[model samples]
Target chain A: MVVNMINRVREQRPLIHHITNAVVMNFTANGLLAFGGSPIMANAKQEVADVTRLSQGLLLNIGTLHEDQVEAMILAGKAANEIGIPLVLDPVGAPATRYRSDACQRILQEVKPTVIKGNAGELAHLVNQDVETKGVDSTGEADHEAIVRLVAEKYQTGVVCTGEKDVGCMEDEVFVNETGHPYLAQITGSGCLLGSLLTASLTVEGNPEDHLMATLSHYGRAAEEAAAHPDVEGPGTFIPRFIDALAMEVET
Target chain B: MVVNMINRVREQRPLIHHITNAVVMNFTANGLLAFGGSPIMANAKQEVADVTRLSQGLLLNIGTLHEDQVEAMILAGKAANEIGIPLVLDPVGAPATRYRSDACQRILQEVKPTVIKGNAGELAHLVNQDVETKGVDSTGEADHEAIVRLVAEKYQTGVVCTGEKDVGCMEDEVFVNETGHPYLAQITGSGCLLGSLLTASLTVEGNPEDHLMATLSHYGRAAEEAAAHPDVEGPGTFIPRFIDALAMEVET
Candidate 1:
């Protein structure tokens, strides 16, 4: 199924709209391009709506939310929702600050995404529960079953909680996939790429669960391959090769 | 003088403050890193002054300009000038739009940069004349002696115009460098990197004319080397090799 989905994405290259933070924009663009998708980053409030109107999917990442950027995100999200394009929300650092948490909630309410993907603490914050979020990174594993159940029930949409293990849950069904390297945590924008991967997978698969599964398996397999190469040192070298692996996957 | 300036930049490794557009921000960062300088980019109106105060040199690029970005650029330029950081201006598309032309004039009038870099049309526009600008690219030769003299007299600052042949001029002096591949223009942020390189060079060479000559020579030499390699086919392969050459230049 994962291979089929990968092939599908390569065949049908979808344009994904991103209004993400500045820190990880380049990594996100390269990741999307490697996975057989195009990325269009538009931040101005005047043009984001127009850009989103023409894109296949919209990914809203609130990693570095400011007054102007937040306003632009809301405008883009509402536009995406109106146009029936799939919206994926990455509520980065939600529990760490009141401004961030409030902004995340506002985007969630306004966008009404088909899928909400975040770390354990971010997901916990969304459900109105207290969780420790260390900056933008997740420190601990989530109570996968309990949190997923609560989130899926409340939002009536697919909820994805990512860590060492990844859990994707709908209202009644849940799927767990444990296949990623600890190296992912050492680098910035790994989760951002994961969000972009999910968007790319959804361009191929209609079912949200199928989309999540394909994305997880694709990322897991590539990480395993990239880790096997001893010369691939640290996060910097690991990144370019991972993209090469994704491209190789497309060919085979 | 240009060769000695290049050596100094590799030795000093200054921090460059870049108030640039979103599309070329990451490329500019990577280019500076490869050349042994640090790049700091922040566009918030409130924080631009503070960031500029800490930088060794400042680069202003208007590749993807808007109202807010133009405001931030003006603020940052003024701050850089006040702090005595060498400022290099790349008037990306001043001849393409009224807003851009007016903003460029406003920035020059207020900030009073040490160096002004642009193509023929942009230089003409700065001197209160109408000239054809082919999109973001230049329509005339960058090494034209007449244009260089005209720009230097009008702006009362050092001027560098880049194309197949790059020209550096200040008042009565002019230097022409004819090297670099056409492939350099195929990439998205090549000119932005040029702005960054000029900033780094000026940190080592106090003279804007010498700084411009040094940067253009190094860039042309590196691109020539990259093009000589058998595997260097397109912009993708050229970028990594360009970085490798810059790094090697530092080490050698």
Candidate 2:
């Protein structure tokens, strides 16, 4: 299933329009390109509507929220909705500042996204739920799962909370994939890159949950492989190999 | 001299304030961190003046220029000028767009930068020079040298033109360092990252010419080493190793 999905992504080369923050643009662009998807980062309100109309999927990330950027994201998100292309929202750094929190809530309220992804901290802002116990997991992990479940239910969209264990929740179906590296946290924008990968995967043929699981497992496995490489001395050395692994997976 | 400059930078950990483009922000930050300099990217016009006042140097790159960011650059540049913190201007992609060209010109007129850096194509816009031959070098190479020299003379600031060979000119001094690989061109923001390295180097106790040449040499050498690694399959793998090389050079 993963190989078929990879082949479809490479064959289709779907365009993923990004209205994201400053910090992760290049990494996200390169990662998408390496993974057999095209990325267009047009955030100007004047052009985003037209640009988003031409894309297959749209990704909105508020990693570095600004009033001007939020305005552009609204324009782009509306265009995506009108055109029926899938829209993915990653509310990065949400609720850290009043501006960030307001921007995320406004975006969620205004735009109808197909999938929502972020870390537990960022999604906690979206879920706003007090958690009870879930199985044998610790409170921390259980809290994350509950948050993901609530956000998925509330938004009527797939929710993914990424950490040591990547948890995906959609329509009473919960999936956990534990195949990542500690080095991921050391680097900036790893979550933002996941948003890119997820948005790209969404454009391919299949159910949203299937694409989401494939992206989650593939990204995790790549990080694991990259971390095991002999020359990956630290985060500095791991990023390139991780990128290479993302590409290598598609081919092999 | 290179070792001493690197040592000074590590000891000082000079804060470099960037009012640059969005795409390269993460890479520039990581590269500077790897090179042992602190980076602060704050492009809010409301806050740039205060931010620049606290920084040891300022780097302005027009890779992704917007009217709002241009305003912040002017504010930050003025603040850097006031505090006597060195400011380095990289006219990235000038003349490619009307907005970028205008932004570069406006910044040059408003800010007295300590050094001006770009490639031959970009410096051509700044110099506005008609070239003649120098020695037996190709007209292409000679044209580049003429552009670098004229810009240095016109700005009365150190100038660097980067390409296959990196050329630096200040007053009557012209230095060339030829130790880069094809892989450097394959990656995004390598030039913007150069602006970061040059800005960090400028804050140390050294002549502008000396620091410029050292940054050119060290950056090129790092690229060469990263490209030569057996694990580096392509540009995807080249970036992480290149970053590791930047950090490794400072330590070992």
DockQ of each: 0.09, 0.16
Interface RMSD of each: 5.7, 8.7
The local distance difference test score of each candidate is: 0.76, 0.80
**Model 2: lDDT of residue B118:** 78
Model 2 residue A73 CA deviation (Å) reads: 1.8
Compose the digit string of candidate 1's lDDT tens values, residues B1-252. 756676777678788889887767877898888877889998889998888888899999876566778788889888887888889999886765565677788788888777788777777777766555445556653436677788788778888877777777865789898878875764556777888988888787466666677678878878888767765544445567777776655333
lDDT of prediction 2: 0.80
CAPRI-style quality class for the chain A–B interface of candidate 2: incorrect
DockQ-based class of model 1: incorrect
How far is A230's C-alpha from truth in model 2 (Å)? 6.6
Quote the lDDT for A129 in model 2: 46
**How many clashing residue pairs are found in candidate 2?**
0
Candidate 1 has what TM-score?
0.68
